[model samples]
Target: MRIVVPAGGIGGARFLRGLKAALGIGADLTEDDPTITVIGNTGDDITLFGLRICPDLDTVMYTLGGGINESQGWGRAEESFAVKEELAAYGMQPTWFGLGDRDVATHIVRTQMMAAGYPLSAVTEALCDRWRPGVRLLPMTDDRVETHVVVADGDGGRRAIHFQEWWIRHRAALPALEIVSVGAEDAKPAPGVVEAIDEADLVLLPPSNPVVSIGSILGVPGVRAALERATVVGVSPIIGGAPVRGMADACLTAIGVETSAEAVAAHFGPDLLDGWLVDTADAGASVEGVTVRARPLYMSDPDATAAIARAALDLALELKGDRP
Candidate 1:
């Protein structure tokens, strides 16, 4: 089966491992691989040290490819900071964002590829050539759409900062008055993105941060339309009025959304999501248009994560009324 998974960082990457395992088991295949297509969020992309660093995309790529720092949930394993330290010694500013040397190598390759007139989708495929993640990973768009947050700076004035700066540097301490995808208005979806959604047997939205991650990816031209027309299911990132991880509350609040499953469902609405999966804890959250199923949502371990993965797909299948 062809599956199109729209995911963000960390949580999205973790669920994929289970999904890969489940598909293998279900098919009775030795090699647990599916024709998976991942539409990764590029909102976390930041230009640091004159290189474009896509954190969410890299997180998914490395995690699935066995190159990620498992504990940190991002960046490379056995990472070194030699380059960062050297740059710091030269008195570089904005040292708040951690870019290790190995991670820098990724950025370098991405930059060089882009400079060679390749779109981000093509560049990512080329990079994944070595990772062999057993899936086709595509950026939502190759356009220069950046997610920026309007926050109150230290000067007691409001200004829009890059999503990375708002999330990493200040750690979402400051309230975000606005979130904007700077180039989304004109950005078109990547080459295979629309086709993947249009032809997907199932579309899964993992428990990724809603606002900047999935939301930003959706901000691109054709994504929301594709989801609106596809067999789509979304797992809640917010459980019991709080996110299981990350500072999603800040971004949710920025758009006047309360940190609740109900609010998130309203934010995404039925136009995009056909089935919505929440934790058994938030089973009471039901709406008119979407099918709501309750189950454990925490990825505390592989078994637990796999259960949620099953719940997510099972709910999708139940809604679609398909055994496979």
Candidate 2:
């Protein structure tokens, strides 16, 4: 089976891990194993200290490659912050975002590769050579697309800030007037992105932030159309009235969408999404023209996450069978 997943950061990475387990592949994938293509969100990409930081992509890579800090769901395990401390000691601005020494090496490599005229897609593939994440990870766009938040500037004015600064520095406390994809309008889908969606037997939208993560990928040209032609199912990030993790509630609110499983499904709509999975707590949730199934959505552990992934796979298979 060919599976394509459009994913974001921590939640998406962990869910992909479970999906691998559900498929009985894990890291022992062979030539005959099912192909999993992960279209990672790059909206969270930022350049810090002259290093290109692809947070979401690295999160997915590290988590799957067995080098992730499980407790924080990000960064490298056994990470040290000597570089960050040194930079802070120099009075560098925006010190709130932690930059680990081990993580910095990855950024340095990515920055150098990009500087040599390599596109982000190629750079990602090169990095994956080391991680061997057991999946083909592609960025949604090779162009420099970034997520920006519009917030009050405290002088009766408004200013746009990078999504990272807003999320990490302000902790998203400032209400977002608008969440903008800075370069999405002109950005083309990264190589193989459209192909992965169009040719896949199954496509999954993990329990990632719908607004800035999957939403950003959908913003890329031709992506939504490709999804419309496939059997696309999404696991709800919203469990009941709240987000499973992250500040997704804030993101949803910024877009004027209620943070509910049904609302998110409605937001994606039936034209793009064929199936939706909600937690048992969100049972009875319904979206017109979409198949909604209630399951345990909390990815509390590998076993639980695998079961949830299995439920999504089963739903997709059942829906696919009925397509004829």
By TM-score, the best candidate is: 2
- Give a tens-digit lDDT track for model 2, residues 102-211: 99999999999999999999999999999989999999999999999999999999999999999989888989999999999999999999998888998989999999
Taking the tens digit of each residue's C-alpha lDDT, what string does model 1 give over 1-324?
778898899999988867876665322233434677899998788888889898988898898888999889899999999998888899997888889889999999999998889989888998898786767789988888899999776788889999888899989987888999999999999899999999988899998999988898889987999988887889999999999899999999999999998779878998888889998889999867888888888889878888888888888877777433
lDDT of 1: 0.87
Q: Candidate 1: where are CA atoms >4 Å away?
A: 25-33, 154-156, 322-324
**Whole-model lDDT for model 2 versus the true structure?**
0.95
lDDT of each: 0.87, 0.95
TM-score of each: 0.95, 0.99
lDDT of 1 at 17: 68
Q: List the residue pairs that clash in candidate 2.
A: none
